[model samples]
Target: MLAIPAVPDVPDVPDGARPRWSVMIPVHDCAGYLALALPEVLAQLGDRDDAEVVVVDDASTDDPGAVVARLGQGRVQYRPNPGHLGAIGTFNRCLTLAQGELVHLLHGDDTVLPGFYPATEAALADPAAVAAVCRVRDVDADGGPLHTTRSYRHGTGVWCDALESLALSNRVRAPGVVVRRSAYEAVGGFRTDLPHAADWDMWTRLAAHGPVVFVDEVLACYRRHAASDTSTRVRSGANVRERVTVVGVVLGYLPPARRAPLARRAYAYAAVFAARTALQQVRAGRLPGAARQLREALRCLALIPRGLPRPP
Candidate 1:
């Protein structure tokens, strides 16, 4: 098996008293956005005794706790890291802090749309599923809608035998997924190796554990800003490099017969995606970023012939 860092076991809690859901908001210097995200979650959890929300600050310069206090009004708990622990570490920290049957690590800057929790919960009613994901809406810095990701199917249901389809690409976003706490314990916490595409890795692992429920409707907003981790990596072409690593990692979980062809398909898709992003950057007048992305695109094209390594 590939060695991913293990997520520390959740602290023992009495089974009967535990909350049904844990919405852990992991924040770092996103107080302004947290102000917007917290309310949407709070509205849905209104008067619900079984759900808990908490904001885990990653030693941000800004005060996300203040936002939690002002808006959460004791409804959302706040915890600060002793020191800066970047996004990945903060996510694990949130995992450790969570005390619910189902955990949703909501990015501090993202929000779940109305009916998101209800719809996903309904879909997850089947006891065999380990996770439930709704469609994500990409939004700009000011919360303006950009576009929604494509639906995996016509409606909400368990994605039966979805491993091969998911291994080729990461189609879900963090804000859209709510995983079982035990599943996090089973696979491991997020790692630093694939910063820009970590969610892809986690989602694939969840798919492997068992069934993954999907709600085709757009039920969450994923914010994209110039300074976000993804945009920063895109500018340096690191995102494409990470995509290559992620594709390699995800393929290891598949059957040997399926690896090679899927590798080609994935590499081809990555190249095309990089090229498209490069073109978008060029139109946006980010010439330097465009150049870096173009270089990564060429690298992806080169990977088509020599397939990525599979697990031994």
Candidate 2:
């Protein structure tokens, strides 16, 4: 079994000297897209050798490992995992390998916009700021604009706004943001349990610890392809159920004083999601899935008329 060195809690080098940004890409059979993505990432670096790009290949069936290796750029380092552990594991592994003060969890298939590095660096310059999230545009496989954008406000405090945001919707998409390594570790990073929404989970935790600077400018183009996990979830029509699961877990993490209101809101969102899921399944002629969603929606709706309660 191949074992790469664990990501150190703190790089041997001091923060005063470590790279300003650590661009981390977690890959699984994304070779076809990496070639297009890597150069764009490099271009965004803007002559900053203090930034490093660590690409962790998660045992891809395609030769992505070799592709990343051939990039031959000293700023970019490549590592292959022992086996396939899916996206969450790949993300965590890449986090472990990062050496910079900031780690941007850029997916292998996503392309960084022209101003990504500069915008992110400016956000992290403030000592109190723990993260910087830029606008993200959803693009088709051919890189055409899909007219969908993930946008949010400059949130106050650490992970608090993140928690509240997830309670609302997945506003801070993974590729849309960059994280301070110290703050990221303070929150203990991504939750392996929520594989489908791990990025949302991490963002919630991250936002609780410090302030997240919202770059109003679009700094990334997130590819919406069938092969991508995001699209797969949408196509499977499991988005509603997956979101419900995420909300439940996030509600559990809130304080007792906030849980009740949050839970009520989460349930309401779940009801809407359930109804949507039921509709999608019915349209697809999947009676079993539709029936299951109908039950879930009914259960949520039944709780609504009872009035929203304060947190326990």
Q: Identify the leading candidate in terms of lDDT.
A: 1
lDDT of each: 0.86, 0.72
Local error of candidate 2 at residue 47 (angstroms): 2.2
User: Which parts of model 2 are misplaced by more than 4 Å?
Assistant: 1-8, 14-17, 69-72, 154-162, 235-237, 271-312
Total backbone clashes of model 2?
12
Q: Residue-wise lDDT of candidate 1 within 14-75, one digit each (tens)?
A: 76778988999999999999999888898999579999998999988898878887999688
- Model 2, poorest ten-residue lDDT window? 1-10
lDDT of 2: 0.72
Each candidate structure's TM-score, on Cα atoms with residue i matched to residue i, is: 0.95, 0.82
Model 1: lDDT of residue 276: 96
- Window of ten residues with lowest summed lDDT in model 1: 303-312
Query: Could you tell me the lDDT of residue 171 within candidate 1?
Result: 80
Report clashes for each candidate as comma-separated counts: 0, 12
